[model samples]
Target: MSYRSWCLALGLCLINGPLLAIERAWPITEGMDVVGELSHAEAAYEDTLIDVARRHQVGFEAIRRANPEVNTWIPGEGTRILLPHKFILPDARRQDIVVNLPEMRLYYFPRDESRVMSYPVSIGRMDWGTPVGTLDVIEKRENPSWTPPDSVRKAYAERGEELPRVVPPGPDNPMGDYAIRLSRPSYLIHGTNWSTGIGMRSTHGCIRMDNDDIGELYSRVSLGTSVNIVNQPIKVGWRKGLLYLEAHPPLEELEDDAKGMDEAVAKVMDAVGERDARVDWSRVRSALNEVSGVPQVVGWEADQPLTTSTSATSSARAEPPAADP
Candidate 1:
């Protein structure tokens, strides 16, 4: 099928509002829990993994892990890099907003829309970890200023650099173009000056997203949207009668949340419900351990009809991706 026909069939069309936002309105088909299609991107001569990731709107580590055999700095020309864009929706409640800390990602379910938008995110570091719970989008601010907490300022001072208490909004500010305040004090879902930090654990207890992603998201969300923060590292979901597993590296600070592959197996068993599935233990174990953020088939019922895999291929641009550094 042509791309237009596929979009018409799947309802995964890129809306006219933004030409280059990382987030896409992925449809939620009845009984199909997984969203987004996995695909491959061939590297050009001047392409790095980072370039591939940026052009594709994925994170650095996601592309790097999926293409482990490829060189990070130089994948050379014509290298086929797997894009781990497909995801298994977490086993948590689908609400207005769900930010999975372990996955370093966010999902937005717009009101009355049969679609969800996904964006890569950066969570808090070890010392100042992002808390898990439901909150509200208390406020929205464009060109938000950066108020370096004493902890942040002191850290800068220790580096023999004097940091300002309140850095006005501008290019020098770490807080990028937009910010959505959470009910949790000093916590926010905001854009960052550095898009490379997306999918990283290096924030000060706030959620940081790519500026372009935020620019689009900030306008779409309302002040009272419910924000549910979860810590789901291993997701087991079904699509087209096939069971797939998507694993993300758990936050270093919260390693005890899930027991790695064992937890994945248990989830699959529970999700299997009435279906008798032939579980592939080896594939499950490898996917859980690799934590490549790509969904891999783990189990399927023998009586089910054969289904085509959505993994496709394309070529990524050699120029800089759609986001600012």
Candidate 2:
């Protein structure tokens, strides 16, 4: 579909709101548990992955993850792209910030607003993995200076770049214009001067957000907001009695081991919990095998026709075969 038509169908207008402030707040009403819908856009001649991702209010890695076959630097015009806008809330109390490392997405649930805002983030590389646990935002800073850790400075020196003990706030500072220091030592949720790395594994253990995204988040979140970092690669949840499975590629460190795969699958099933739903092992296997990072309807109420369109049943349902997985 043309960009205009896609936006209209999704009830989004390109011109009215702040491009970075994409509000995807779904009210938490009884019996409803999912937010957002699957959508798509056609690439124009001048489009890059970051351009499309920003326009759609999605993250860079998310768009890339959903369209692994497309060229990141230049997807030719007319390439139909999958927007992985649909999501299943992580298995946790929906009262604070939740960063799912495997999916490279961050969800912020504001207590007073009764809404959740999500953004794509670049996490640490395999050798410097972001920690997984509960923490609090203990400090907030604007125009924060960077103090290169010993490890980072040493790595840079080895590459023949002279190291500075501190990087002042400016164009050269990787911390961009804002930062939120977590209770975890040396870890932060901060903005980057470079946008290309916002949705990939390119950081040094601190969470990285697009400048605009981090700016907005920095302003709204308080000094003590709870932050939970998790590494769930597979998620299962229900929306109006339909069971959906969303899988992300296992972290590179865990992908080759059968035991790791089993543990991941077990976590997903555990998240599904005691909901009155049945599992279609076939669909489950397909989702597990694909690891598409898009939600798939794996089970539903027995009375509901299995072949029925999830889109028809609910506006936000994610059906099969369209997502990149």
Off by over 4 Å in 2: 1-21, 254-276, 305-307, 310-325
lDDT of 1 by residue, 118-144 (tens): 988888889889999999999999998
Candidate 2 local accuracy as lDDT? Answer: 0.77
Write model 2 residue lDDT over 1-325, tens digit each, in one string.
9885575466342332235445566666545556788988887776666677777667776788788899875677888999888898887788889998989999998886667788889999998889889999999999999999999999889999977999999999999999999998599999998765667889999999988888888888998899999877888777877778888876786556433335544654564566444555556667777777888887676455556643333322222222224
Stretch of 10 with least lDDT, candidate 2? 315-324
Name the lDDT of candidate 1. 0.78
How well does each candidate superpose onto the true structure, as a TM-score?
Answer: 0.85, 0.83
Which regions in candidate 1 have their CA more than 4 angstroms from the true location? 1-23, 306-325
